[model samples]
Target: MSLLRLDGVEKTVRIPDAEPLTILRGIELDVAAGERVSVVGRSGSGKSTLLNILGLLDAPTGGSFAFDGVPVERLRGRARDRTRGASVGFVFQQFNLLSGRTALENVMTPLLYASGRAFWRRRALAAEMLDRVGLGHRLDSRPEVLSGGEQQRVAIARALVRGPRLILADEPTGALDVDTGATVIDLLEEVAAENGAALVVITHDPAVAARSASRYRLDAGRLRPDEPGVAESDEVAA
Candidate 1:
């Protein structure tokens, strides 16, 4: 069975006076365990909206979505929150690390909400994740002191510390230099594969998208297989 499936998923937002705005239209997708999927789109193509839906941060207004054989719409309240917290991870363009906290602490924040051993051993798990990301020596360094790439690595460590089954990255390399971004993407792919997690990368960089086994283009709120050589012609936003 697919790890996650979206069939004819649609998302529409209502405005006060204007007609409803549809961000996603008939989005059909399926991602299997340990798969790497990349989505490339221009600005306003609903990539972020799709990512939000896939990560369980938002609901679709139409069609259906299922994660691990369970219908997402059927989960309610804390059950939904707990399921999302335990099964999904997110890495954003800004890194989103706590400014005043050390790398270890930033990574440990998620585990605090986990029950049983994960809560008690949050420190060790966070440390191990940081080490896996090659930041073992910088565990005590704060986000302000870390470089952009290091900060992103810390964010990746935090996202993966819980061993989530799905990883959603939203323009994760947008803020870094080309070489640094390449390194970070490589690390992200490697770690996700190691953990046997499904990775969905929403990016503007063709180089990043090309690395994934499955590539798609999101245009005018529609998703389709990426066309050959189209990445060079498309004007994607950073």
Candidate 2:
């Protein structure tokens, strides 16, 4: 089933006393449950803006966007926050972990906004997630003490702790060495698949995008199918 749907989406930012600057135009994309997709784009190609929109961190200025069959535009304020927190997980290349927090504590961060018993059982859940990412032994390790690969693994554990329906990874391997990055990506895909979550990796690297079953290119604020067998007509419409 389709977990995410975006059509004719646009994002524009307004500066003081100036005309709005358009960052994304006519963006169309769809992701199905348990599917793996990738969008490749160069720096300054608006991929980050697209990522924010896809993650529900920012709303589109035009067109329709839906998650789990509900219109995102219809959600307001905290409703949006709850929906995003429950359904979307994010991984960044920089491994945005808290400086002083241990691996386990960092993984438990998401439960801070959680409701019901999930919040109460946060410690066990976090430990389980950390173990899933092979960091159980490092539960007390701080971000500063971990290697690049280890830190990213901790970040992954934190992102997946809530079992988000969609995993949005933005250049997740950017800061690691080639072999380490590949290993981490492999682990990410395996864990995401095991959790039955759709994975969307946004990167400028062709090799990274090639791992996905569906490949698209983002250029000039538009997305087009990038794989050879995928026809131009199959491009995501806007």
Candidate 3:
């Protein structure tokens, strides 16, 4: 089943006395559960805007979006927040770990907003996730004391703690050395796959984009299949 669907999605903002600036236009995509997809684009190519929409952080100005077949337009306010929190996980280029929090604490933080059993078993679950990412021994280390790769692993553990079905990684390897970045991506893919989560990697690096099962190039707010001679998947909008 598809975990996400986007058809003719667009994002536009109005300017003073100027025509509305469109950051994204006619975007179309679908990511099946447990599938890995990559979107590669230049710096100003609306990647972040698209990621925001995908992660439920913002709404598109037009077009259709659905998560597990439920239209995004129908999910309002707290309902939207709950869905985002419960079903989607995000890994960022900056790691985004809290400074004073220990590794275990950082991973446990997401559960603070969770309900029922998740909040009650937060520590155990967080520790399990960190262990899954190979950080079992660094549970008490703060972000300041960990290596770049370790910090990213902590971020991944935090993202996975809620057992989200979709993992959105935005330039996830941007901050590390090539070797460290590769290791981090490997861990990210491994853990997401193990958990049956669909992974969407948004990056500028060709190598990074090539890691996914399906690939697309996003240029000038438009999307096209990256594989040469491969017919564009119907998942792309007409």
Candidate 4:
């Protein structure tokens, strides 16, 4: 079954003293559970905007988003939060860890947002997730003491804590060096599959996109599927 779907979605932002800008215009896509989709595009092509809409961090100005067989735009407040928590996980370029909190605490934050679980139950689950992400030894360390890769691993643990059905990653490796970035990608793909979650990776690097099962590219505010034979290196930005 399709875990997530977006149809005819459009998003526009209005500046205080400037004209409006349309970040995503009538975009459509479907992601099957356990499928890995790579969204590739040039800078300013709305890939991140698409990720935001899918992650439920931002709403599209028009059209609809269906996640795990539920319509999303019409939902608000707790209802939307409930669905997003149950179905979506997000990883970003910067690991947005809480500076004052330990890595375990940061990962536990998302589970706290989850509706049904009690604190003690979620706490145990969070620790297991951090251990799976290979940061078991640093669970009590705060973000300031962790390396970039370690911090991102914490972010990944946070995303997984809710047991989400879909994983939306926006330039997750953008801030790390190439080797570290690849290792991060490896962990992401492994965990997503292990959990049976669909993966949507939005990035500007074609080489990164190549790691996925399928790829799409956005240009000039529109999205399209690339020819099957397209090489990841060939899609690299000039």
Candidate 5:
């Protein structure tokens, strides 16, 4: 079985005074272990919406979601939370690390929620994660003190500490320059490959998506395969 599966997913949202609008419609996809998939689309193309649903951050109005062979479309409360924490790690476009927390501390946050290990006892593990992400020397550096790429690396380290089977990254390289973004991408590819984990990156840049094994585009709430510069797959194949 694939590490993660989405079968006919759908999501609808209601604006304050407007009628309910469909953000996602019939999104069916799968991500296998060690596979790197990138989703690219314009701002309103439902890329973020689909990622949120896949990460279990938001519920789908229709269709089913299964993670690691566990049926989670209808799961609620502890069951859903448990599945999310145990199977998925999410990295947002913005480095969501606390400004006051050091790199090691940020990496430790997931472990605190996951391993149930004491805060002090998990320091070594956090440090190891930082090292793995190429931030060994910056272990004690706070987010504010670190560069944009460093902060993103810290966010990545935290995501990795959970040892999650799947990662949902939303514009992970959005905030950095080309050189820094390339380094960050390399880091993500390295660790995830070593761990045999699946990674899904949401982005708008074809250059970024082209680096992935598979790329999909969301356009007007429709999902289609992406082929490099061409937004549509047919253009590249023919």
Candidate 6:
């Protein structure tokens, strides 16, 4: 079964004294276990909205979304939170690390809400993940003291510490240099593959999008299979 399925999903938001604005129009996607998919879009093309829906942070206003064969609408309140917390991991552009926390502590934050062994061994798991990301020595370093690449590595380790089933990365390399960005993407893909987790990367960079096995372009609230040369042209234009 597909780990995630979205059929004709739509999202609309109401504005004061104005017509409802639609952000996503009929987004159709399916991600199998351990698959890698990329969505390329310019800023304000609803990429964030799509990522939110995929990550279970927001609901689609119409159509259907199922995660692991269960309808999203059916998972409500605590169930929804629990399911998301257990199954989905997010790596964002900003890294989003707590300023005061060390790399190990930042990674351990997710496991604090976990149950049993994960919660009990959060420290070890976090340290192990940091090591996996080649930051074993930096575990004691805070975000402010780390380089952009190191900070992003910490974010990635934190996101994957609980062994989530789906990894959602939104412009994860946006703040890094080209070489660093490439390295980060490699690490993300490697870790996701090791965990047998589906990876969904959302980015405007053609180089990043090219790394995925399946690629789609999000434009004006619609999604379509990426056409040959389209991404290159878009990058040139940008």
Q: Pick the candidate with the highest lDDT.
A: 6
Candidate number of the best TM-score: 6
lDDT score, residue 181, model 3?
A: 87
Tell me which of candidates 3 and 4 scores higher on lDDT. 3
| Pairs that clash in candidate 5 | none
Which stretches in model 3 have alpha-carbon errors above 4 Å? 228-238
- Clash count, one per candidate: 0, 0, 0, 0, 0, 0
lDDT over C-alpha atoms for residue 16 of model 2: 92
Q: Which ten residues in a row have the lowest lDDT in candidate 2?
A: 229-238
- Give me the displacement of residue 126 in model 6, in angstroms: 0.6
Q: What is the Cα-based TM-score of model 5?
A: 0.91
Q: For model 1, what is the C-alpha lDDT against the true structure?
A: 0.91
1-238, model 1: which lDDT tens digit per residue? 9999999999999989898888888999999999999999888888999998898889999999998989998888998899888999999999988988999999999998899999999999999999999999999999999999999999999999999999999999999999999988888888888889999999998899999999999987888899876543343322
Show the lowest summed lDDT stretch of 10 residues, model 5.
229-238
Q: Candidate 6's residue-wise lDDT over 104-188, tens digit each?
A: 9999999999999989999999999999999999989999999999999999999999999999999998999999999999999
Candidate 1 — which pairs collide?
A: none
Give TM-scores for every candidate, taking all chains together and pairing residue i with residue i. 0.95, 0.92, 0.92, 0.89, 0.91, 0.96
What lDDT score goes with residue 174 in model 1? Answer: 98
Q: Per-residue lDDT for 222 in model 2?
A: 78
For residue 212, what is the lDDT in candidate 1?
94
CA error at residue 24 for candidate 5, angstroms: 0.4
lDDT of 5 by residue, 62-134 (tens): 8887877777756889888877877788887798998788888888887776645544567888898899888
Report residue 203 deviation for candidate 2 (angstroms).
0.8
lDDT of 4 by residue, 1-238 (tens): 6777889988888889988887777888888899999998877777777887888878888888887777885679988877777788899789888999999899999877665554557878888989998888988999999998899899999998877888989899898899988998898898888889888899877788989988898765677786656533323211
lDDT of 3 by residue, 1-238 (tens): 6799999999898889988888889989999999999998777778899999999999999899999999999999999999999999999999999999999999999899999999999999999988888899999999999998899989989998998999999999998899988988898788788889999999988898888989998777888888654432223221
